[model samples]
Target: MARFNHNKHHSSTTKLVFLISCAGLLGAALIADFLWASSSSAAPAYLSIASSWALEKSGILVVQNVTHNIAHHKREDVKDRKERIPERFLPATFADLPAPELQWEEMPSAPVPRLDGAAIQIKNLLYVFAGYGTLDYVHSHVDIYNFTSNTWGGRFDMPKEMGHSHLGVVTDGRYIYVVSGQYGPQCRGPTARTFVLDTETKKWRSMLPLPAPRYAPATQLWRGRLHVMGGSKENRHTPGLEHWSIAVKDGKALEKQWRTETPIPRGGPHRACVVVNDQLFVIGGQEGDFMAKPGSPIFKCSRRLEVVYADVYMLDDEKKWKVLPPMPKPNSHIECAWVIVNNSIIITGGTTEKHPVNKRMILVGEVFKFHLDSLTWSVIGKLPFRVKTTLAGFWDGWLYFTSGQRDRGPDNPQPRKVIGDMWRTKLRL
Candidate 1:
């Protein structure tokens, strides 16, 4: 054991001596290098250059472009980084925001002039139904205009030829549903007709009848349900105070049941009620008749003050109704086209407030837009022609303005030359 311990000590001594020897050799080599460098410092600088030139002649060393190399590297680094986007590609400034572009085109005329009717498009076909027709008479005929062929081909006559029948008609791409409307020229009490037409078979059937017959009410399809609201209770044009809805399971599978949604707080008559982006918006209509009542022949522009509504009401997330910002102008005698162009809810053309002294009415042909993001309304543009009491629908970024009664200058009630003129406006993209 003692011998083994001595051998281990001897091995350690050997390793230590070898390390010291290696360090001494490295120090000697470094000293020699220093001496050589010191000697070369005294040599002519041109000798080093001459050696480089000789190497280049022999092609052993190559000359580099130092300036060009540095610049190229810097350029590559900048190239790899992102470039600032061009002005044309940059985010839109206030001045660069899109301006409204509207154009109107006349198409083939309807066989009969329609007022206070509904226009719904199924596929490429447009169906125009019940309204006061020729001679201010009420009639029932489903006029079908096909845009695909650019012609009026087929027709469906209503079972009972009654006019002013329904305030609105809605479709779920397959079936067109017509609800209660006025009966005759007098625009008397509403009818109980819940007419459903099948576009596929070109046949009509009755769904469950409207609980109470009423006309001029705003009706639309919301979340697969038929939503009806804010229309005349009396054929004399009293706006109803309540709103209602019935579930339509699919496009055509409507449950024969009605459910109360919410009572409108104000302005039921002549308001445009529409569902855009799942939000319900009702805008601009007559609030109350000024010094007017039943059994009176001159039911307009009385000595008493009138109330035209500029208020806007909206239905919300919790199945409740509330007021959004009011419209800027007071407009009554509603019946104009409300169209949704992408994110903008556009209301165009309506009868305006009556003059205070002259009692002459104003007709509005201006267009207003409600932007969903900003939650505000602004005037985008005006219609090319002053028109009102029109039926409108949007398809493929185009707004189809159907037959509507035009505004006559300074007349008490615009004389009924309800037009059969068809015009189309499309946003230029």
Candidate 2:
């Protein structure tokens, strides 16, 4: 029943071949359309290709392999593009920045040479209070420095009754509180007078006096109260253990009588007192003090009897004094030579113990950092020269100090060069 029809067979074969060609062209057109759609829209390349293949009923394995190859090539292209970009044009982070260099700059000198003075910074103005000037005379005027102008603004008279040296000074931004100190030159007896100065009005007002006068008391303001503790008593050689507080608000004493608190474990003067996070810290002082000749006129004093100590103490929330790690060495005459930076306290320029071999007074020149969190101390840097009674301040990441007594030489027993030269250094952390 096989009939030989060559023409019919050829026609059927040609039709079959034509159908195969059309199917191949249709698959190619589908791929082209999907690629164009992916380029012009947000649809993913692999997703577009998969949709096109699903409609064509292509092999699942073939679709996956081709899509994976395309994805791989796209990843490579992105990597190449990133490599073409410059590093500086990219976004930066704090870690990428360089550390600040430690460089010191000398600024305009203060109006008058001062030692044992008190300085407080309010906004852009620095107010320097009474201190020992040239020829052992007391400076009764307040010197001001305008940081914006880099020049001494002028001088204003301090209260005539205000003590000239060994004053306990503190500030609450707008007001400066001056506590008990030696009323005049040499080793004069301490005064019980307390004064407050309104920096805005440039006026001084007397407050309720201290129960007992003190020399270089460790004074600070904390928890709406003015605290005074640890200083030389009426007998300049005796260290007082008395601790007192007065309720104060808006620069005025809210209470009449000074209330007694727990006395400091180590009672002495010339200590750095600071209030941080509601905690009070007392650092560095001496047991004995410079005393005047029994009946000498001008009350000439001798420093030979003093015994410097590196003791540190802190008053806690429970109002109990807790002993802290002492300084690297004995330091004194640094009542105002400390500044808080971040979680650390930076101290510079103070009087240390006398030289062991020569028995000469040694001045501290190293800048010290005390980390409150770690309870550790580190020598961060050195000062241009050894000094004491330096008034330290911090502003805009810079540490500054103005007036102090500079060391004459390593062998000199006493610091005879009092300076008003100001110096500042940039700080990082």
Candidate 3:
């Protein structure tokens, strides 16, 4: 140690104070940086394929920015970041797709970006109807894509906006029928009324209301009539099991009816239904509400792989629900990717929630092929990205999909997003 003089001691004290202050400032800045980075990572953005088409062997498509959740990120302070964080799935990838087999085409620019609706192919035209868009309900806006001209040109106004997340839609060669949708930001509730549009007249009309008023149900054309099944009538904490049917004639309403065909032995959440060979089958959903119910929840995050259906039911044999062989994968939000390929029901890209015992939402595998006749499921292939199983459908041998609420186990009710990324899985079968 060295001795210090009074004058020297005073000078040293001043220098030490200055150094301490500088260190404090630098520490504060580092903490601020950490907080900012954590918040930025949580912000969610809208992702969609503006237009998807096949290239020589790979799939090429233009992706667009639709909507995001920057506001939700600002609510948390530095400490709150640990408990609650937003999700940003950016810098998307398409490398998961098989190379030298399927590809996508580049689009110029989209006039408007939308998602969570139905696309009906009429003659050479593709008509899009009510769906949850980047904004509120995507109503009063009808878009027509002409395959012959290889361009998009027609637009019509809808009477009212019914922002349904996963409702059923079907075209009867003359009119397009949209029925049973949910209306709200969350897309969890149910809508009562049905909307119809005449392709030739370009006019819209209303039809008889559904008895129970369900949304996100699966529907298809069978025997010149429309069949609807599954979907939820209550919140995510509650589950509903019901089926409905409607008959149409000459672009006009003929009859409307609802029936409780078969109550699922053990009702599940987010049930998926599809039709093949004049027979409709219901598959994969949660067994009970994990958040409110007093039991282990089945699904956590939506898994990309599908396996082990709880119960498989067929709508035939005296209209009684018959139990077919169970699906290889049990899934929820699955009906949309299902299509009839060569008289067989080809299903794809649905998610399974991990049993709620863990309480987390994750992305799983893609499964397809539930033979209605033989009562079995086979894997076709998987999707490059994880999607809500409910946001897919079959149109003209191509599988089309939209954005929806993906089950993120119990950690978060992750919004799969009401995106406009329209993907078409062009198949040879």
Q: What is the C-alpha lDDT of each candidate?
A: 0.64, 0.80, 0.54
Best by lDDT: 2
Residues 179-225 of candidate 3 have per-residue lDDT tens digits of 76756533334577777888899888887767766655656666666
Off by over 4 Å in 2: 1-102, 410-414
Which residue ranges in model 3 land beyond 4 Å of their true spot? 1-115, 123-125, 134-140, 147-153, 161-163, 187-189, 234-237, 256-272, 286-311, 355-358, 364-367, 372-374, 389-418
Once model 2 is optimally superposed onto the true structure by TM-score, how far is the C-alpha of residue 242 displaced, in angstroms? Answer: 0.5
Model 2 C-alpha lDDT versus the unseen true structure:
0.80
**Highest TM-score among the candidates is held by which one?**
2
Instruction: Write out the backbone clash pairs for model 1.
Output: 164-182, 165-181, 166-181
Candidate 3 positional error at 301, Å? 17
* Model 1 error, position 120 (Å): 1.4
Q: Quote each prediction's TM-score.
A: 0.67, 0.74, 0.60
Q: Ten residues in a row with the worst lDDT in model 2?
A: 87-96
Query: Model 2: what TM-score?
Result: 0.74
27-123 per-residue lDDT for model 1 (tens digits): 9988975565456432322244565565556544323323322321122245433442211111111011233556677878887787667777666
